[model samples]
Target: MPFSTLGLSEPLLKALADLKYSEPTAIQKKAIPVILSGKNLVAAAQTGTGKTASFVLPMLEKLNTERKLRGKRIRALVLTPTRELAVQVEQSIRDYGQYLNLSSMAMYGGTDIEPQRQKLIWGVDIVVATPGRLLDMAHQRALHFDELEVLVLDEADRMLDMGFIEDINKIIERLPLERQNLLFSATISDDVRALSKRTFSNATEISIGNNNASKPKIDQWLITVDKGNKSALLSHLIIEHQWQQALIFIETKHGAAKLVSQLEKRGISAESIHGGRTQAMREQVLNDFKAGKIKFLVATGIASRGLDIGELTRVVNYDLPDQVDDYIHRIGRTGRAGASGEAVSFVAKDNFRNLCAIESRLGHVIKRKEFEGFPVKKVVPLSILNYVPKNKR
Candidate 1:
């Protein structure tokens, strides 16, 4: 449905129109009105489903009116799991609130605290931050949530997975108990449920395909090859497909770096982003990838959740992620917003267990493709789940 029917104000609608966001995604359709009504909400939405806009649009609409802030008080706060996500969500706020008078900032660590402190001198209307950095600001008396009107925990599941529950609780404790609360997650695990129950009061729950088997827009497939020849197979597939841009997921920082070098050696320009790189470098790399300056980006799991790349047509799993959930997120980088996309994986024999888990999660086997000159020396046996040995049985 058109965004105009979603109760968004004219200014927000104008901003969305400027960005050519004509239609609202499923999450936006469900979550926006509830947020506009100032009710507590718990939404289960996956990445790449335009979930960012679901919250940002309504938030800007809610904070549309001006309120004088004290020295270091914020009207709304959004807590994200990663620095990348923090930056991206803040950017979305800015983009959607362009015509409004509200001000916002993305607060995160890995940089000088003094600059962040200085920005807090005159509090922003909205602040998107990571839990640890936000707590640091609060401790140093650079931020005050006493008058905060809205509190949003974006990607709550990921935050819990990264062991940020304590920090999250600490931050939540400092906020006004009467404020509106909103929690959005890709998966509503037991931990996420507990957090919601602890903090939220009769929240309106919205779940859109949280437990679905698969995304039909994404065509997932795999190629079996030896570990040693996986890189060569990736190069072959890229050259054969003539793919202009694709996010390649690897297992480690070192592996990401090695894959970039290997791709460069094959005359394909590429870049890498991981924990080892400085925050500035990671941000710049993300910008380049999004801007199409870098056609191939080799990233570890750090890039899985928060690096928002739009209309990405393809992704390559240089190494399958250990968790089936991660496999879904890695491929989620593509096929966003109902766009047709491709996900290819280089699977070695040793990765059989991971493959089985991923396929089991999808409720089907991934289509297998054999590349010329990339014959499998050790064929991966077909996945046979629920098999118990005679003795065990």
Candidate 2:
């Protein structure tokens, strides 16, 4: 159904139209109505399923109808796992709430704390923050949630994985007990469920897909090569396929930087973002990539979650992630918003265990193909083979 049928206001519908969001995804359809009802909600949907917009739209609608003053108190608070994700969510709020008069700000580390404190003093209706920075601000008494009407824990699973449960609990304890609480996660494991139960009261729970499920619109491909030749394979695929833009993930910050340097030597426009760089550098690289100024972006797992790029068509795994969940997050970067895309991974002998774990998580074998010039020096593990359909093998 169209967004209009979901009870969003004209301004939000207009914003969605301008943004070309014609219809809601399954998660959006299920979660929006429940969220709009002012009930606590715990939603589990895979990344790239428009989970951001599901909660964002309803929260904007709620804020629009409220008549509260917003000078000293944050009316809505969104907590994210990383600075990049916090900025991304803030951008979505600005884009989707473009027509509204709401004021929003993103608070994260790697920036001057004084400027953020000043922004809070100037006042904002919504605050999107990373747990650490928000905790810092709270300790300094720079922000308060006395008037908070809604609280969102975006990427709840990731926050827990990142060891932010104590900070999250501390933040929650400061908020008024009667406010709406919403928790959204790509995967709702036992820990996530227990956290939700402890925080939410009689919440509506919605699981749109199985945990770590790969997006169907993504055509996943695997190529086996020698460990040292991954860069060659990546460059070959990008040039041969005429890929205009590709988000490439590596295993280390140093690896990301090295790959970008190699790509540049090959006359490719590439950039890298990882924990080693300051937050400003990462933000600038992400902006350039989104604007199509940089065709190739080499990133560590830091870019995996909550990094949304419009019409991103390619995601290459220069190095396989350590966790299957991360593999899903990396591939989910492409094929977003119902768009078809491709995910190609350069697998070496050392990455076999990661590949096997990923295949097992998805309950199927990824399509494996040998590139014309790149010959496989390693064997595809029998475990991965076991998950392959008999006809395909």
Best by lDDT: 1
Instruction: List model 1 lDDT by residue over 43-119, tens digit each.
Output: 99888888889888888898888578887889999999888899999989888898999988899976898988888
Which digits, one per residue and each the tens of the lDDT, describe model 2 over residues 1-393?
889999999999999999999889999999999999999999998888899999999999999954756455789999998888889999999999999989899998768999889888856889999987898998998888888999999988767655566678898888998899999987777768989988977998888867555333899988878987788878887788787888888878888888988889888999988888877787788889888888899888764434557688888888888877677667766775457989998888888788888888877778888778877767656554675578875
lDDT of 2 at 238: 77
Q: Clashes per prediction?
A: 0, 0
Off by over 4 Å in 1: 1-38, 42-75, 79-112, 121-126, 130-149, 153-179, 183-201, 205-216, 303-305, 385-393
Q: Which residue pairs come into collision in candidate 1? A: none
Q: How well does each candidate superpose onto the true structure, as a TM-score? A: 0.66, 0.65
State how far residue 97 of model 2 sits from its true place (Å).
Answer: 14
> Which segments of model 2 are wrong by more than 4 Å?
1-38, 42-76, 80-111, 118-149, 153-179, 183-201, 205-216, 303-306, 384-393
Poorest 10 consecutive residues by lDDT, candidate 2: 301-310
RMSD of each: 7.1, 7.4
